[model samples]
Target: MEPPPPPPRWFQRLDRRLRLSPLGVAWTSGREMELMHRAMGFAALGFLTLVPVLVLVAAAQPSSGHGFARWLGQAIGVTHESQLQVERLFGVPNTALQRTTAFGLAALAVFGLTFGSAVQTGYEKVWDLPTARWHTMWRHVVFLALLVGALLGFVNTPAPSGDVTGPLTVVVLDLIGTFLFFWIAQHILLGGRVRWIALLPGAVATTLGLLGLRGFSQLVFSPLIASSAVTYGPFGTVLVVQSWLVGVGFVVYGGALVGRLAHEGRVFRRLKDQDET
Candidate 1:
């Protein structure tokens, strides 16, 4: 593999402030990269292994997923009955199995790449190193599956709630889960070893960013979607796509902030020593 290039002169100049960013912490902490790699492998494995568990748990309840789906569809102007039909189409025993398999495979591919990219980013930052070969990436993939499975089994177990609150809660939880997944992916990509507490800062930053985006979207875009007559049509699709982009912007910015924080911390420490002298 080729040696990773050093950061450009501009980034180097801002290195102190960057340490406080997620990317900076990732870059500075080689151990974290290794942890991230391992955790990613475990997470993928967890996705496959936990499908049955999640399905079983979900199936046992009989009413959880459909309820949420129904409520979402209605809130979005999709009639409750239309939502029910969609659920039924996917819920047949055979169909559900196939859906689960397809979902698992897709997740494995999506997150495998996602975690790997994060690892590559961190590896580049810390050591000026490039990613390892596919074999190395595979090792990380396996590690991610395991790590993610454990986490889902623990933190993500569903709570039975009929109250089914607002769209904002749904959006918030979705973003929170996304942040957690990315945080864990970073841990796995690094090597499945990190201080769990180290994850909190990144998660906190990400969640806050997501919430802010949510508020902005509600204020600026919700009415446009709400006022539309088309449900499950091209107009609705466009609205959903637009909202997704807004959310994604927040997530990407949050990640960049993570990188910057780490860079900043190192610069601060170095300067403090010079000042002492």
Candidate 2:
């Protein structure tokens, strides 16, 4: 077989720089990019299941009041103007809505579970463990419950009005909530394979990454949403949301990678000491 071709000069330099930096070490060692791609695939699946549920719920409500849109805006901590845009985007006629049924809910649950399962598999791969199946259903159920709680917390907490404090409070709450969720998720999804302390770094990283993305969305997605609304109408909302999900997938997986690397480093040190003795 022919030997592989050499990497490009730019890539070689970039790789070397990554090797030198601490973050780069984790990124490379943890196979962060590859994991991110896998995560995006599953996250997309979750988004597919999730969006329909949101749409159905929104459509079932009276569109005249924009009640669903307003709820969603509160859930994500967006401003009033953004809330109106969301209302315009998601507000579907009641006549077109499908009734929520047991079968539909079951299917959504299965699809939504796949994303968490995928993340669990990714962490298992990182830790060099066999695939775990025991208690898998229960774990997914717990994850779903946690997700619902987080959403409820977000939507129920009113954003302070008419001052910078409101936005700051929103950001702080989002950060804290995300941190707690990711931290808990790391523990539950991984099935207690690693200590909680080992998971903190990645949880923190994921929280910060999410916060950064939220800020980026505020600056970038608002205009896109406005333009898309004018151009593609309601479908544009779907496009924007899917795009956001892709970013979220990367952050979620990347954080897992970071945590895995931390756990591995500790294990490596312990092994090395044993060898020396």
Candidate 3:
């Protein structure tokens, strides 16, 4: 009997489906996970840098919430009376949740942009490719950074009158921006020529991840909220540092997973074809 040809490299291991064509699959299957890791890492890193800047911003205007307040008044065309009412409800950096949320939100975007670049590089590695030049990869990141920054601004901003309009606007804008960012990032990292329709999977995955993480955080960290406030003390600092490390690790693994799945799906169908032949 004639010997069968050796299996293709993309199908070298029939059982190891996860290791097949990891680069190709990662562009689709694992992109959202990579983005999640990037976002979390950036937010954590941002917190490290932003706390100090916020302290400085706070010190500069200790007497009033003027910096943020003015930003609000101008952004949404609200009257001073409406702004003051919000200020009273949310208070200033001295002791307001808004202050923490503001710094947190800003850090999230800044650091997310930083870490996202690294995640894309990891994606490139799984594709057995050299890292893309900054020129090639940067415009996408810059666009995402601006888009996310604007969303964060809206999320952190206090409502003009505690009405639904402002918060609703922020939510709608954030969701739309997030979906667009996903589409663009995938295009850049995967070098895929795709339309926005191709991004539906990414959008759905991201929304699911966000919701899942929200629930996980609420369940896992809820106890800490009441027991002791977590801060940047040594222990909390270690935890934050570890989370970023873990996030980076996940990005790499996610890239590989994506590549493998894409490779496998293709190879499996090819193998079935050969058997039929």
Model 1 Cα displacement at 191 (Å)? 3.9
TM-score of 3: 0.46
Q: Report the lDDT tens digits of candidate 1 across residue range 177-257.
A: 666765665555545444445554555666566556556654544444444424544455444534544354334434534
Instruction: Report per-prediction Cα RMSD to one decimal.
Output: 10.2, 4.8, 11.2
> Which is the better candidate, 1 or 2, if ranked by TM-score?
2
Per-residue accuracy of model 2 over 186-241 as CA lDDT, tens digit each:
78888898789888888998887777777777776766666776788777766766
In order, the Cα lDDT scores of the candidates are 0.49, 0.71, 0.48
Which model scores highest in lDDT? 2
- Poorest lDDT segment (10 consecutive residues) of candidate 1: 67-76
lDDT tens digits, residue span 6-96, model 3 = 8888775653665444444455545544556554655555445433344444444565455543443333233444444334322345643
RMSD of 1: 10.2
List ranges where model 1 is wrong by over 4 Å: 1-61, 67-94, 98-129, 139-182, 192-201, 228-235, 238-242, 249-253, 256-259, 266-270
Q: List the residue pairs that clash in candidate 3.
A: 20-260, 21-259, 22-259, 22-260, 23-259, 25-258, 26-258, 26-259, 42-111, 42-112
**What's the number of clashes in each of the models?**
65, 0, 10
Error of 3 at 124 (Å): 2.9
In what order do the candidates fall by TM-score, top score first? 2, 1, 3
Clash-forming residue pairs, model 2? none
